[model samples]
Target chain A: MIEKKYRDLIDKLIQKSLMKKVSWNKSSRETEYYVHFKKGSFTVDNWVNDSSVYVDFTLRNANGIEIVSQTFEKESNPEEFNYLFKLYKAAEESYIKVDETISSIINELDEEDTVGKDEEDVLPF
Target chain B: MKRFRDPVFALIVYGIGLIIISFGYYFIPNDLKNIVNYISITGTFSSVYGILVAYAQIMSVRETAENTKLKIEKSNKRVMKILSVSDLSKAIKIIPEIQNYLSADKDESALMRLKDLKGILLNLKFIKDIEELTSDEKFVDALNELSIHSANLSKAMMGTKTGLNKSKIISDLDNIENQLNEFEGYLKYGNYD
Candidate 1:
């Protein structure tokens, strides 16, 4: 049984999922989820369907673009809700990780833009 | 008989006065009659002047009150507009949206989200009531800085999503947090620093 607090958390996450463009699906045959994020030099795609949960992303470097795809197949378990819960949790983690990485790039670039510049000269607004 | 109630008795005094005055043309010589005539004409003119002055004073006071009411109504309308939307709340809500796109390594989306924030800031700017609420200029400065950083962030990540400078990304993230914090602080509280 999901605790009331946990229920609230899931409901909140569900709302957030909607806002973040994460898709959730439940049909008679299968359940599915998807999250797509494109960040610096990388485009990440995560999918959780009936058969398996998979992550496919592209990484770009000097050599060339590298596409990485991994599928985590569903394993029989006593808990029916286990995979559903885990996929959502993983999506949340990935979402946060991707944000952190992009934030880093933006912050680093911001510093470069400000280096050796007088505070007064930055913006005349 | 004083003739307090009866019109006949009342007219008796006036008639007697009139008779005296009429006879006074002969009784009160020409010089005295001229003096009486001067006083009567002066009284008439004085009463008219007094009435006109009182009327003028009332009009002047009413005009001043009308002007004051108009100014107050204008100021109140401005205040109402500013309070219509919770600027602080709107600005605060945008932080997570920005962070979400950034985390997704989605600079494009992040930049777009910044546009939303920019709209919010611009809206705040349009309403002049903010000046009365807070005195610090840093609030506006912080908003402007966030806009620039957001734009630069998307532009830098535009062409090649693969060749991202890790160090640059790190610094950019820190910069974003700092600016966001500054803006949030200014909105939530009046603290500039």
Candidate 2:
């Protein structure tokens, strides 16, 4: 089983992500989670073996191109793992900001459509 | 005290007090006749005040009920406005295709897809509610950026290859998809509902 802290982090990330998918690797003894966004996507792999807990952070571009991939173990590289987490959060925020703007654009365009329509054409029927 | 605040209960209590007063009126001595009259006058004023309070309470309750009903109707209308639009899932599907084209360096194809997206946005029905959203500064600025970047990219695709901002256009489209998803989420599970 994955450690409690790692599991909680994975859950939080998955919750924040727009389109998320989760899976388990029986042979590898790891849990994999995928969060897909329009700008990019990221995958988190959590593994707990006999000695230490391992987490892999893989960041992908819009076209599923692997831009950054790194693995960190809890016992050794706590600072590096924290940095990876920070990157993940930054990416999530970027996606959120972009999404807000695009939504506004679409809404504006729709508003124009409504304005262009004559009053007579707007009947509920 | 709580029961006294209830108009019907207060009226019943007052009615019983009047009956008791009428029954005890004859028991008063002749020497205190003036005092009895004074007490009766005070009681009358108190009764009148009670009635006035009860009327005010009734009117207040009625006003609150009307306001709540108006609020509900307004919210329902807002929900209907969002639901009445054309299928936004179409835009969701088109966004990925546009991204694929952009990633593949097919600028011509990406431009066509962007036009298609614009067409879809412009053809959505019952979108008058969107006017309120346009007032937000961040949203307005973002829309403007997307428009400017899109125009620039379109020009480059046409002929002017001097400032081909492909990355910027891709980023803009990405942001659009994110915003579209957010809008869909609000429509599906908004706090207003």
Candidate 3:
């Protein structure tokens, strides 16, 4: 049996991992969640009929990461759906971390060049 | 305790003996029965020898066919890997050059570079889609890297043209460069086997 507590933890992690600009929606048969960052968007869905969850997301810069993840479980419960939503949120948060980490590294590279160019522009003949 | 049976081999030996005896009766005189018997024995041995030679030829043909198939598969994999890596390298070389020209505010040169980059990226995407035709992991990874880099470059250029925020454009360019470098590492070190 899958523990509800673990599922909840996963949900929290996904939520924290994503960018803050995320939205959620729910219907009788399905629920959808998404997050949009500077360059791309991440989305996940849970279907009531199959008791399954699917995730699709993209992270782009000059290089981009696109990922799709899906998992199915036998039992259906409101609690499980709630946990899945949390997981989706956590995944979005995680993606943001990865994006920020890459962005920061690149930013560091530009810092030196940018400062040098600024100084050159300010120099008097 | 029962007798051991070698049904097929036994049947084949018996059939050969019968054929030899019949040939001896038809071709030799009864007065020379001893000579005919010797001739029959020789004929039986010759028939067995012919059968063994035929079986060996069939096995060799099967082995040749299998080897040819393996070689063709390997060659196909090698060709696919080369094409994929070449596409990736071209994209990496072209995109940043175009971005730098744009950043330097050389509109005319940037436009020309953009055209070149776009054409190369389109070609890379096409190659990635067809990568499934060959089962070469190195080639697939290279093609994937090319496709990703192309998309990032496209986004960066479009951001620049559309007057997106300066910081955003710079960020996108940085991401593109990182992707290209990662791709280069894969190309240099990725195992083809």
lDDT of each: 0.47, 0.56, 0.48
Model 2 Cα displacement at B85 (Å)? 10
Kindly report the docking quality category of candidate 2: incorrect
**TM-scores computed on chain B for all candidates:** 0.50, 0.49, 0.54
Q: TM-score winner between 1 and 3, please give it.
A: 3
Q: On a 0 to 100 scale, what is the lDDT of residue B99 in model 2?
A: 77
Write one digit per residue (lDDT tens) for candidate 1, span B1-193: 2222345554564456555555645665566667567567455655664565556556767777899999998778656543524665566566676666666777777777767765665565545555433223444433434433443355356531123333343343455445545544554565321
- Give the alpha carbon lDDT tens digit for every residue of A6-119 in model 1: 446445545666465453321111122232222212223334444454433222321112333223333543242453355455455545566657788788778746535588
Provide the TM-score of chain A alone for each candidate, in the order shown.
Answer: 0.25, 0.41, 0.31
Q: Give the lowest summed-lDDT range of ten residues in model 3 chain A.
A: A24-33
Model 2 residue pairs with clashes = A99-B178, A99-B179
- The TM-score between candidate 2 and the true structure equals 0.37
lDDT per residue (tens digit) for residues A1-125 in model 3: 23555445345536555644334322111233344333333345433333343332222222124543334342444454555656654544453455667788788777755423566677686
Among all candidates shown, the one with the greatest TM-score = 3
Q: For all candidates in order, state the fraction of native interface contacts they contain.
A: 0.00, 0.00, 0.02
The weakest ten consecutive residues by lDDT in model 2 chain B span B133-142
What are the TM-scores, per candidate, against the unseen true structure? 0.36, 0.37, 0.41
Candidate 1 chain B lowest-lDDT run of ten: B160-169
| Model 1 stretches astray by more than 4 angstroms | A1-125, B1-67, B70-74, B77-81, B129-137, B160-193
- DockQ (C-alpha based) per candidate is 0.01, 0.01, 0.03
Per-prediction backbone clash count: 18, 2, 15
lDDT of 2 by residue, A6-101 (tens): 556555665544332222111111133344443444454445545666566655543234566567876787865664555344444444465667
